[model samples]
Target chain A: MKQFLNNLALSLVGLFIVGGLWALLSATVSPDLPSPWRTWQESKVYILSPWEKRGEMDQGIGLMTAYSLFRVAKGFFLAILIGTPLGFMLGSSNTFFKMFDPTIQLLRPISPLAWLPLGLVLFRQSEPAALFTIALCSMWPTVINTMTGVRAIPQDYLNVARVLRLSKWRQFTKVWLPATLPYMFTGYRLSLGIAWLVIVAAEMLTGTPGVGGFLWQEYNSLIYSHILLSILTIGIVGFALDRMMGFAETKLRAI
Target chain B: MSFIELKDVSKSYGPRNVLSGVNLTLDEGEFVSIVGASASGKTTLLKAAAGLIPYDKGSITMAGEAVTDFSTKASYIFQNYSLLPWLSAFENVNLAVEAAFPDWPKPMQKEQSEKYLQMVGLGAALLKKPSQLSGGMRQRVSIARAFATEPRVMFLDEPFGALDALTRATLQQELTTLCRSVGRPVTALMITNNVDEAILLSDRILALSRGPGATLSPAVSVNLPRPRGADLLMHDDQAIRVRNHLAEFLLAGSDRERPAQRPEAPAASKDVPVEASI
Candidate 1:
């Protein structure tokens, strides 16, 4: 409880200092720019109403925000599903490392947006395109983290498992998997952040019902306050997800 | 019964030979300690006996059966506090128990974990993580966890070497009592850099020579009274003699491995740790 209060106090102090400065700057610089007050009011109009559709319905931000979150969630799951096993392979097999390292390096530097067209070509749909793009963007961190985690486990731990004759499955589940989970989760957190960043661009491409799509629409309509509203929503949600992952990591590692 | 035999056992890593021509036999339930200077083959020999590393020549046999690779039921307590960093102290101990007895009732498993932690004087540390515990506390948890497995033989590779001297002595006392207790399925083989530790607790101390090539020098038998305590064990003449012999072996072995071109070595007597009575 004491820790909770301390953290709350720090957060409030930080929020007020930053928020007050932003409000002052916006109020002075341009009437077009929404002060914190105007932006908060715009957020209520654009965000809080969940039934607001993306392009077709009233131009409120709710549906698009949910869509963006869903795309990120799908991409994160897809990345975990594929990236984890690949990481295990890379960590354990010298051959896999040799084969994949060059390809991974070649591909990782190319933008997630670069894959957007290819994803559309492959999937023949907007949702799949968004997911594929997010997955592509997120995969490197997850795979690299897991592989390094697996590699970092001390030889003594393996020796103990071997001396006790841990079965291959038992070893994977008990030793290999748990040992790597922390690493994998760390990767997952990084990937989630990346996926969140990519989703807006992805939605813009797809014209999908998401904050990205709404932001694009608001720009087209020249409604800067609504655009600010969508961007704020994305930032807040992205920050929350990262915080969730960090909290989980703290709990897991402490145990 | 010559429960374990290592005949002409040799191990090499590519061009570097660690142990060569090690011939030793351990009988049923005999407690032994292997002592040596840093870089000696004490740890190497223990690893070989545990079948963690394959010997290039000869064979290591347990109960007349040649052991190849690591056996199915051994518990290894490593010196570097290799308690799975993600597990709590109780969970670390419980995991070992679960592996050994998968079918055990849940409450019973928890009870057994608590029992072992209590034995090591760490009953309050059950929920604490490895990072939250000190070096001495971590070593004790690892020891308790290994013992919780009720292993046929517990192979320790200097589990207390990293700890401070006082903590090492305290653990030694705990280990002696824990192993000597009736109806326990444990037989201990610990490797140590501390010569005093070997003399205090071992029934037999196998000194490993230092190496570019190293081997077990000779096995010095300790006839100290069982269930030894600090007060009674401090005055034992046999313990003193064994400690002196180990000190001599450790020094001579160190000198032999490196040529006389090195700085003159300290006297072996000064190297002996007389204050160690755990």
Candidate 2:
């Protein structure tokens, strides 16, 4: 409890320092930059009534965040479903690794922007295209991490599997899966972070109704304060998502 | 009857040979230990006999069946405990029990696991994971896992080598008791650097020569009576003789100049009767 309070106090102090600096900048050197007070006042409607909808592009901050979260969830789960088995195969089979590793390495660093047009051509719909971009961009982490996890299973544990004469199926389920879980989770966490990041860019390009969409829409409208609000919401949500994954990873390691 | 036999076993890693012309046999219900210095190919020999790794030459057989791979009839206790960190004590043991007796009812498997953990004095720690347990306790869980399978032949590769002297002695005693009390006789093959542990546990002790290519010395019979303890080892003359033979073989093979002093026995053991060991 004391540690938590200490962290909270420190966080508040940090926020205060950054806020004061921003206020000072707006009042002096950058007069066109919105001050903290002005931003808060202008953005209060979104904060106070986060689920409200004024128009097609004017939904409250909560609704926008929820939409972005939904798309990320869909894409992240899709990445997991495909990437996990791919990783398992790559990790366990030398032939599979030799065959696919080069291709995966070649494709891994391609930007979501580069993939978006391809997604659009294949899916022919903005939503699927956005999801395709999000999944493809985020999947590399899960695939790589899972493979590394499988590779990293302690030799003693594998020896135990062999000594017990555990059937291949039992070895996969009991030894391989459990041993790989913590690593797989690390992959999932990274993948989710990537998915969240890709959703913003995907939504920006696709004009979807989400946090990224709201940021783009407000920027086009010259609503500078709302753009700040969207950015803050994205930062806070991404932090929360990461913390949730970290908590899960801790639990897995304890197991 | 010979329960498990390995004749002229040899193994190599790349260009370096680990074991060469290693011949060993364990009679039914016998407990045999191979004592050697570190890196003397003890683990390689144990793994070869258990069929965990393929030997370059020679045949291993259990009950007249040629051993080409790890036999389901055997169980292994590794030096490092090797308990799954994700599993509780009961679960670790239960996993082996389930594999060894797959057709048995789940409740029966659970019962068997609980019984073995309790036998190892881990009834209170049944729910504890390996990380939550101390080194001694984790090894107890590994021992429980090994015995729970009711393996026909047990291979122990320096099972207590990682433990402190006190914990190692305590576990050696517990293992001795467990071996004697189990319902059916189990043929055990163990490897260790500890001469006293071999004296305390085995019916016979063999020495593995220093490696590039290690070979087993002829067996030295550990004819000390059963129900042995660390105290008995000091009190008995035969124990001293066996310890010296094994220790000398080890010291002779190693490059080290001086032997480390053995830990002092408890003062209370001074009053123990010599006849008690006989």
Candidate 3:
């Protein structure tokens, strides 16, 4: 509890420093870059009435963030569902790894931006296209981490599986799953971060009615304060998502 | 025929020979100990005999059937307590009991696991994972798992080598008692660097020479009374003689300065000679 309070206090101080710097920069150098105080004033109406929706493009920040989060959650879940087994196959079989590893290596470094057009062409719908881009980009971390996790299972544990005469199914549930959980979670955490990152860019490109869309719309209308609010919301939401994953990982490791 | 036999077993890692011309046998009820210094290929020998790994040469058999894989009838206790870290003491034993007797009802498996954990004095620690337990307690969980399976053959690979002296002695006694009280005789083969441990547990103690081409020496029978206490073994003249003989053989193999004494060991122990040693 004490440690949590300390972290909270430090984080508040960090926020203050960033706010002070932004205000100073707005006052002196970048006069059009809305000050933190101005951004708060402009963003307060949406913040206070989180669920309010005036129009399709004028929804409250909460609803916008919720849309973004839902898309990210869907894409991230798809990544895990598909990537985990792919990782297992890659880790366990030399033949499978040899066959697919070069392709995975080639695909891993490509940006979500590069895939966005491909997704649009394939889906012909903004929401699904955005989701496709998010999943395609975010999946690599989980695939790599899960593969590494499977490969990292100790020889002693494998020996135990053999010596105990555990059936193939039993070995998977009793040995493989538990051993790979922490690493799989690490992959999930990273994948979620990437999903959140990709959703913002995807929304900006596709004009989805979410936080990223709000930021892009405000940018066109020259409303810099609301753009700052969108940026802050994205950052805070991403941090919260990472914290949730970290908590889950901690619980798994405690087992 | 012996219950388990390894005839002319040899193993190598690339070009380096770890064990060569190694021969061993265990009768239906015998407890044999292969005493050796560290890196004497004792573990390699034990793993080969247990069918956990393949040997490059010769054949291993269980009741005249060539052993191709880890026998379902055997349980191995590892030196470092290879209990699953995720499982509680009870669960670890229960998993093995479940695997070994798949036809048994869940309640019966649970009962057997509980019985063995309690027998190992881990009744209070049934819920504790291997990470939560001390080294000795972890080893106890391992022992309980091995026994709960009701394996006909037990392969112990330096089972108590990692514990402190006092804990080691106590566990050794508990193991001896557990082995004795089991319903059927469990043929055991243990390998260790501790000569006193071999004398305390084994029906026959065999010395394994130092590698790169390690081979076993003639067997030194431990004829002391059953329930051999550590203190009793320390004072017994026969135990002292056996300990000295085994120690000298081990030291001779490891010593750098002394000319290699090519003792005309029994046919079972004679390897390709020590000419390859640096």
Greater-lDDT candidate between 1 and 2:
2
First chain of model 3: TM-score?
Answer: 0.97
Find the candidate with the highest TM-score and give its number.
3
Worst ten-residue run, lDDT, model 3 chain B?
A: B269-278
TM-score of each: 0.83, 0.90, 0.94
lDDT of 1 by residue, B1-278 (tens): 67778899888989888888988877767788887766656777888899876779888898778887666556788888787776799988887787778789999999999999998889988899888999999999988877887777878898788988788879888888887763754567888877667777787888787665777878998887766665544678877777778777766766555554224445453333322322
Question: What is the RMSD, in Å, between candidate 2 and the native fold over all Cα?
Answer: 5.8
- Give every prediction's interface RMSD: 2.4, 1.1, 0.6
lDDT of 3 by residue, A194-235 (tens): 999999999999999999999999999899899988998999
**Predicted candidate 2 versus true structure: per-residue lDDT over A67-134, tens digit per residue:** 99999999999999999999999999999999999999999999999999899999999999998998
Candidates 2 and 3 compared: the better one by TM-score is 3
Across B1-278, the per-residue lDDT of candidate 3 in tens digits comes to 78998899999999889998988889998999998766678899999899988889999999889998999899999999998899889989999999999999999999999999999999999999888999999999999999999999999999999999999989999998999899899999999888888999999999898887898888999899989898876689999899878877776665631235424334444322222110
Off by over 4 Å in 2: A1-7, A27-32, B251-278
The lDDT ranking, best first, is 3, 2, 1
Q: Which number leads on DockQ? A: 3
Model 3 residue-pair collision total: 0
